[model samples]
Target: MPHAEAVALSGHKILAVGTTSEIEALAGPSTRRIDGMGNTLLPGFVESHLHVFSGAYGRKLLQLAPITGRDALHKAVRQFSDANPDEGLLIGQGTPYGILEEDGPITRQKLDEMEPVRPLILMAFDFHTAWANTPALKAAGLFNGRDVGPGNEVVVDQEGLATGELREKNAYLPVLNLRTSGGREMLGMSGDEPETPPSAQERADDIAVLKEGLRYCAAQGITAVHNMDGNRYMMELLREIELEGEMACRVEVPYHFTEGKPLPILEEASRMSADFNSDMLKSGRVKIFVDGVLESGTAYMLDDYANAPGWKGDPIFDTEAFAKAAIEIDRRGLQISVHAIGDGAVRIVLDGYEAAQKANGARDSRHRIEHIEVYHPDDLPRFAELGVIASMQPQHPPGTLGLPLEPGISAIGRARWPYAYAWRDIVDTGTAYCFSSDWPIVAVEPLIGLQATQIRTPWADDMPDQRVSLHEALEGYTWRGAYASFMEDRTGRIRPGMLADLVLLGGDIEAVVPDAFPALGPVLTICDGKITFEA
Candidate 1:
């Protein structure tokens, strides 16, 4: 590729690419000029995986990013709760694992000491772990402890009382369910439709929330998104935006499937794919959670945790159950993405993909594994062999972002240190890869994430080296992501006949230092040949 100068758009497609005058000559009447103003231009970013509705809603809640001290957390909660006394609950986002080291492991007594009367929950940055106050637990019926499925747990004290720490969704659903308005939005669920239909004002408000999220993504140079959480409600919301001609990005929504559901339920997924197929809104994929995360020690590991002997984390699905689900989805010809965060989970998903191939005869299934935080060496090559896409997030912050390595790295055991977050190792294996922010868990800005992937300094001389070049990192966020979703032909690149989804930065990207990427902004954003944003 050469250093290009200009591009001309015809309706929703790129018409020509060349020098400024060469492009201008191809432009016809009624075509508006969008000046670059001496800024860099690139294909608008493809946000690979994120929860759209929840990320937008988190902006209105208590944020605790970059806070570690016990006293700091206490003060933040008090200040937020005091200012918003009318709020139904006090929920905060972005608490890192390091906080446990500073304040000791969080417990019911610890949370009660901070504020016993009010219901409060501090969700971990991973969204896999939560610390609920006594009120929140009691309200959810976990006060005396409830037996949940394989991977879910309600941490309890030695005396058999419930601790404040809640592992996975079922552990803390009660606290999250209390929100009357915009509550379902936070959970990224649309299953429970209201018995009473929403008024026009409420519908408008819901649309506003969706628009706000899409606009935010555009400002960050994102013109396409594979929203990880999905349901008919989410699809309809995006459909409404497309109907109104307000959509500024292409979306690939999925039908989230839970374990133990009958195979017949897949009929709805097929119908969804047929009914909602469009350039703007589409759904034909299925999302599954095969395991939890490493932060809470629930990430389903192949070996026992260094901190806990004879206890490897459990998978949400056992071998036979997952194999059955994979065969059904594969037989339906739908793409699937599994949330496998540990080596054990990763191996099972790989095996399931392999079994699906053996049963149905091989095809370009392109199944995916989200958050390969750690993996076993034997399973590394299977990704390329099985044609699985490794979807990862760069702003995860713990691996090379200077956060304390306690609990996580140590818990994984020194023997498995090399296997944790090995980006270079995975990329070297010829496996397909894509990057995302997983916003509502981390910052959605790609440049900020680029800093960690392209310029992260290892925590120690002995830690594994996993540095990726800036060009490769950008590709992970753009063309590669498009390829993963089968949209490479229409939107990933700036070429003739492709959708005019492009972004203009304020300066030459190649000349800027990787660390300074956070300072860069998308000065102009054009999506589907429409000017959606200008700085």
Candidate 2:
């Protein structure tokens, strides 16, 4: 953490970092020098969790505000369906929590009034719950009310027919899987690979969408991304981008480890890891979902929801099953990152990691919990003890992004506010935590996350020391993220010989005053040896 006044770049590595005079001496006459104009410089942001293709796909769908009332909801749905007349399914994203007039989830019956012929699906921001029209339900072959094991429901009406509201991936994936080249990639479930890969033209479309998404990330100073989705289709799409020389930033896809999939999936994870082990495009990790998100009331919790008595949300994998999978994956040496949002879910995931350590012996396994949204006081120490990485998205906190207070905050109840979004708590307990956007779930801008990280009101009253300084928040988005992804040796620093990945802010980031970080962004972004974006 040296105080650097100037840095000299030699090819793709830093040649010198010192006072302005010392760095100037190393700069050759041919060097291209750009004055900072008083803006701060730092390593490019490393986004720890985002689904590239899914996000690209969401970019195409209609985004509805959670509270868009009944009439407006229908009007927008009809307009989108009419606009895309050729589309078999008129999909929508960013649907609000209480779009319908009544409480509980909006039913498919209501959607049918908007467009009875075309299939309609408006998914929740959390991606766990979705409301569909009758046509969409029939399209997924669940209109007859198909049962999908424990913890997943199709929301049948009193007549025993599907109501078009689906809960959990087990319920909605049936519809998503029907989309061409769309499947369990979002859930990170292994073996849901499409029976037929994307055709040449489809890959062309994928390339078009994904390349644009990558550019958007680069514009925000994102140098590297730890993509949370995995499947052979996405892997192939990224490979095509790298082969065509369209890759502008580093990308890594995980091996989605899901339930009911055999042990053979872990072996495929190893093979995929070895096949695409390059800096630009790679795969050497496994992603799992221990529970759903809190917004949907599916986030497994130790205590029952304040709204629902006698029941706490359940984990996707039973205790013994998770233990087995964690042990196997840990032994394989591939990194493990799980989506655990609730305190109960977090505890189980930690227990599984502890079991893996005991069974496979210890290694530098930087096992991660994707969203430790609500951490139990008791389980707070397990993260440090098991050497877990707390992968969090600051933007997912309540009272931001137009999120209503009910679902995200109230679902956990007022009593747990101190423990929810406990970034300061985890850091104080000596666990390494990294930040991500979880794009398509919230705003993707790291700047927005940084701004959200500063809000400690009410929460400050509960914890008194939950707010983080700007530097610590910046580190969570940089070097610590690199460390979480096992890429610290080459990236995430401005020292000599390290990668030449830097972002120049247009505005003076350090002088922006507290609570004004949301207004800042990069003016120029350089990745590797190339300048990817320039304002």
Candidate 3:
């Protein structure tokens, strides 16, 4: 059997897997063995896409304000400010509208009276929007009539004054920098520096945060994580961690191409790719952000948002430019992962991939489309036709549900709704799919994501029609996740010759009620022949 509860198993890879007595015959006197203690053993989970560092740091930085209503958020900010009198600024992240009572947008004036002296910046649950105080705006030099950046907008009042709400990076970047810089200074003063090289510290912190996130993942039986954020410093930090032998889980780092930039970074990325040792840390592919998110109304929609008419989502790069970049990257023998959320963005990404395929002929580039949330019905089959991997986050649908599904799902209509997660549909078409937490945006628990996949309804919604089978959900987190990161050969499965990464579940998932799977927590997580977590 691939996974067995009782064990006296030992080897670089799985030497023998069976019942305790059956496998004990192969063990020598010095064979190291671990008792499952009645836990259900399974292959270690793999996360297809996640911001490891950001998720880790978010745990320590700000409080998540429940967007129950305007009053609840206002009260939370006021209470937080009151609790930290000496704190320079108030920072809050992950404020989703599903929890809010107000249907309209949130404005900065709501919190003006709470603590105007200190700057405050609160990120929306989507991370695509920001609510900033006047002082914080001024600090970012966003006063007067300055334009934010492309794909971002400043929420202004009828009087043309800033309303404290910013959408996308255009408006959020300025304030985000201020918050990050300020947080860094605060961290520096606390003498809690975890790594070195001033330029590399941010990247190192991300890795440190990711390492901590791994603990949470391990608790859920995740043995491998595919990091999609690409930065020079991040690659270096990964190398440092691997050199020190501190890397417990397998990681595949993909480089992302910056918007409006040439493919020159690909050469540098290739150099880094050379440094990647497939043993533990490996360089898998390159990433590109073709569009924004659907919830924030910046996801580059073909049609306008149903709730907010006359607004089509923004595309980070025009179709021609995006296609050109894809061809160049693909031509260089590098795999590509594009972020396409809206239907329009999805169409654009597919067109680009098709163009790349036509130009370069068929190859095993394994180009993937990240966050394929809204897809044009016509484009669904093309994913499998082109051999593309749909790296999706199951938590998004449940987490962002209840927001007038029109703009995101209704735009595509009922026929496509059945294929939202579309795992069964996509697999039927021969396409590979995977699941991830997209942590920091959502929790990094693979089990939670698996729970969400099995039970598509958000925490508040008790709908049963949206649920999928428990077996399908687990495969998305395991084999599919490994395939998305190109680690299927060594990490996703528990077969012989594969890495000995596995997790011990508190209960047998197959025996649990389908609806009650979320309650099944992980008891132990093993990675690369090492036990990283036990609880």
lDDT of each: 0.82, 0.81, 0.69
lDDT of 2: 0.81
Superposed model 3: Cα runs more than 4 Å off: 1-11, 65-67, 82-88, 98-100, 180-208, 398-421, 457-467
The most accurate candidate by lDDT is 1
Candidate 3 Cα deviation (angstroms), residue 197: 5.8
Clashing pairs in 1: none
Q: After superposing candidate 2, which stretches have Cα over 4 Å from the reference?
A: 101-104, 177-191, 459-465
TM accuracy, model 3: 0.88
lDDT of 1 at 314: 87
Question: What RMSD, rounded to one decimal, does every model reach?
Answer: 2.0, 2.2, 4.3
Error of 1 at 131 (Å): 0.9
By the TM-score metric, which is better: model 1 or model 3? 1
Sorted by TM-score (best first), the order is: 1, 2, 3
